[model samples]
Target: MTSDQYAAATRSPTDTDVERPADRSTEPAAIAVEGLTKRFGSGDDPVTAVDDVSLRIDPGSVVGLLGPNGAGKTTTIKSILGMVLPDAGTVRIQGVDVAEAPRQAYARVDAMLEGARNDYWRLTVRENLRYFATIGGVAPDSVADRHDRLLDQFGLAEKADVPVRNLSRGMKQKVSLASVLASDADVVFLDEPTLGLDVESSLTLRRELRRIVEERGLTAVISSHDMDVVEAVCDRVVIMNDGRIVADDTVANLRQGFETSAFRLTSPDLDADTLATVRDRFDVTDATTREGTTTLEVATDSDGFYELTALLRERNVTLASVATVEPDLEDVFVELTGENETGHDGGDSR
Candidate 1:
């Protein structure tokens, strides 16, 4: 069956505890992709860039789309934005289907794809903003007002008169973002926004994104490989592998799901006999001697951490310190996708 047919078959449950038709004009999500699939090349050599994928992004939420290289994150984003047509899928933006009404669907969103560079490179920054504002259907008299505000918001007021070609990479990115803001769309798609930015610039961009989402209730789908960036900005994350979603959860929930009472123990006097006793109860992964101190890394699947401590205590094992190891989104991603063993290859490393 085609992607749309699959979506139609698998209906989303309503809050009223009833199953409704997929195209029944329900409350529109900020962005929705149903059973999206895309393939490239031809015949026997065809590669499925994006497999059967379905996602619903609520309004006013910031979501991260994460995956390793060749995992179809970019393809999914592009298809949703109408930049690349999915072979079989239905893309809805604010209740409008792109397959049926591309213009109306795209009207609800403004996006910055991996290499989204606006035209008018010869025009100055301010001029380019004005040009895009006009294209976005802003009134002529309102252009200057919107232009000034975006310039200041994106910290481009100083370089308003500078030509786009003369702007730094970071500045160019800011300008692209400014154009999106000028469009006054309800949703934004940022694909690797901090791909090539320096530390300071990346932080600045992240702060701006947070401010934009909070101040305007703007929904966003950020596709990036940088786990730190996702952890810092996204409210929830959707992890994809081989064009399929492996995990979808809030950042906090994901961390909590993987949380374990793993402890790092250090001792000046090493005891092989004590180690043997501990191994019987704990899953000891690493033991090393460094600088006269033997470090033990132990992982526990149950509530035996206190027992382990008591066992050490009974043996007079010198416990230097005990701390719980908290899991982060990166850990969850690694555990779910098994990408760490193969080495992660995606947008940018954190």
Candidate 2:
């Protein structure tokens, strides 16, 4: 980013004070949506992008929005950001109705959507940051220290004077994130923020993002396919399927329900008949054999596990190893969405 860009970023139309609503006893939610619905196309084959979705994000919390392609995640996010007009819904940002007062509602909000496209390719990194901060209702000089800190945090200080178009794809992605932070928006939406970033960069971003959110008491909604990023940064995960919310809970709670009843056992048995008997008596989810030892994954409770062991001993099978199979976020996602529907649905909703 160049100093010239910062100099040019003066007060603009977005400069408005956020007005808090009256007649409320406590602070309002950071984001509140009621009966949100959206549809595309017409005729007999109308497609519903979002279906009566209602969500509330508390202040100073990081929530993850996850879904497969065409699952209405993108549409829901757009509606909340005021980019798309919902057919039926009321969106309120920090107690301010977006429809009733968009400027005041979104005055302290920022978003980085469509990857690195949010940045100006012709502008220098520093200039882009300054311009975005200005448009977010603050003078560039007011956030100069913030811009400097963001540049250093994202390792963009060295490339600050270089035009964004001349940077690498990964560098450009960093620049986009830096610009969003420079705006100093209390409520931020980031879609695929870690896309195109290397492993180190992704880790750095996650760490910094968590620290900043906690320090500033900011509310963030992150949408990404990278489960690791979501698991690491978000306090809660909201999963959607077929335009509806299927699961909304903390990561530990989601996984805890599936952690039990899954185990891996390895044994050396006599023959095929024994394997078939074991399969018939238990739910053999997976099986593999190597070096005359068969490894089987079974889904059963504590009692069933005891029965399994008894049956194995009766068949003269010598157990080699045993371990519990822990379910991760991906496993939970597949279980809720169906394995076959985990990929794109060939729709235009997203």
Candidate 3:
């Protein structure tokens, strides 16, 4: 929910032990999508871009929708926002059906899609926000206050009067974000929000987004290849691959559950038979030889380590060092997805 809805929900308390979910007809849904399927092209080469994906996002939560290039992530999001109609499935934002009621469904959502594509190049930052706010149906009285709040929070106050053409990519991004917040929409959709941002700008925006969701209580759906940003800003993540969701879980839980038994093994002048055994048996991800010693990087599950040690001892290979390394989301993603590319096409990972 947006800042406006946040106050109203608090003012009215349910008499029951637990408050009914925020998705009731009267309350408005944060987000809901079911059985989403979409196909692009036609005839012999019809591409099924999305295949039976379903997700329900709760109010006051941030969900990161992640995937590799051509994994149908962009297609899935487009369908959800009603930019493209799915062959099947439904989308509901704040309890309003997007298909049945486009205007009502979109009113509660503000999206910053692609790179600065949402902002007008000729308009000043303040003017752009003002214009979009009005178009988004923001009340005339609340528009000024919303603009002021967003500009300050996003560090766009200093660049308020400058035209979009004169601003740096980061400044323009902030301006786009301010325009988004000015509407005070219940759900905000940001696709690659940190693209083209410097280290500092990326850090600043990521920090501000976390703060925004917590303090403003606005739901956010972020689609990005930047796992660091996703880990920092999103409460939940849905990982998709090949037009289908491969993994869906919280950032912490996914990391905890996906145990990668990775070990580095070094041996003195590894024998061919032993080398063949390790190569053939274990998932050897990397190998290097130096100073009369060869090192093998093996990635395996819980039981594989025992087999690895035993096999090494029997082969007379002098094992030097073995260490377990904690796996991050990028590593997890690489193992889980075949496409590898995380954003657009051609495998240059988003």
Candidate 4:
């Protein structure tokens, strides 16, 4: 949906109270995509960008949309946002069907597309926030307190009067985020929100995003390649691959599903022959020796580990320590995708 549509749709008889459906508990999902399909290049060699994908996001929750390059994440997001017309299926925002009523559907939605590009470069940080609030059918003065809080929370209060173009990249990214939150939109789409931020800035953003969503009862869909950001901020994760969703669950569940197989073993009595025998019998992912102590990381289940320990005892190998390796989101992602993946989303623009 265009900015004009957003402004027009959100406008109501009372500007102070942004138009919102009542009783969210009984309303439809914050976002729902059913049987979504999109393809490019229609002839014989047509490229199916999204194939029969469906998703339902609950209200007041943060979801992470993750995928490697060419995984159709971009196309899927664009279709939901009404930027690209899908070949088939329906997209609804807060119970309003996008195809039936684009303006109403997008009225509750806002997006920050690339990093800091969402903000007007010539406008000051506070001005950008107020301008976006006005466009979302909110009077600037009505949300003046909110704008001030957002600027201060994002550490942009000092630069509130400075032009966005004069700020650093990280500061501009913060301004972009602040502008998105300035609006009264209930559902937000953030694509690579931490793209240009430093470590501290990223941390701050993650904390504030979770707080804002909880306090305002907002729903957020975050698309990012940064696993740490996703893990830190999202309540659920959806992984897409080959134009389809391959996995969807809580982060803890995803990691727990692939748990207890990887382990590290440290030994002080690993001789050359014993190490060779151990390597011959098991999958040794990493091996290192420092100051006469050898450490080996192996991937195996409990039974295989028992067998290895038996062999070590017979060969007079002394175990210094053993620890199980916990899988992180990145590890779970690689295991799910079955390959090392890198790059931006597929098609439909970055």
The most accurate candidate by TM-score is 4
Top model by lDDT, which number? 4
How many clashes in each candidate? Answer: 0, 5, 5, 0
Task: Please report the TM-score between candidate 2 and the true structure.
Answer: 0.79
Model 3 residue 63 CA deviation in Å: 0.6
Report the C-alpha displacement of residue 273, candidate 1, in angstroms. 15
Which residues of candidate 4, in runs, are more than 4 Å off? Answer: 1-27, 267-281, 287-295, 311-317, 341-350
lDDT of 3 by residue, 250-309 (tens): 665556544567887788958767788789988998888888889888888668988889
* Whole-model lDDT per candidate: 0.76, 0.83, 0.77, 0.85
Note the residue pairs that clash in candidate 3.
Answer: 29-94, 29-95, 68-341, 68-342, 69-341
Task: Compute the lDDT for candidate 1.
Answer: 0.76
Better of 2 and 3 by lDDT: 2
What is the descending lDDT order?
4, 2, 3, 1
Query: What are the per-residue Cα lDDT tens digits for candidate 1 across 71-130?
Result: 788888888887788899888888788889988887757777765565467898888777
Candidate 2 lDDT by residue in tens digits, 48-99: 9899999988888899998777889999999998999999989999999999
**Better by TM-score, candidate 4 or 3:** 4
RMSD of each: 6.9, 12.0, 9.2, 10.3
| Model 1 worst lDDT window (10 residues) | 1-10
User: Given candidate 2, what's the lDDT at residue 191?
Assistant: 85
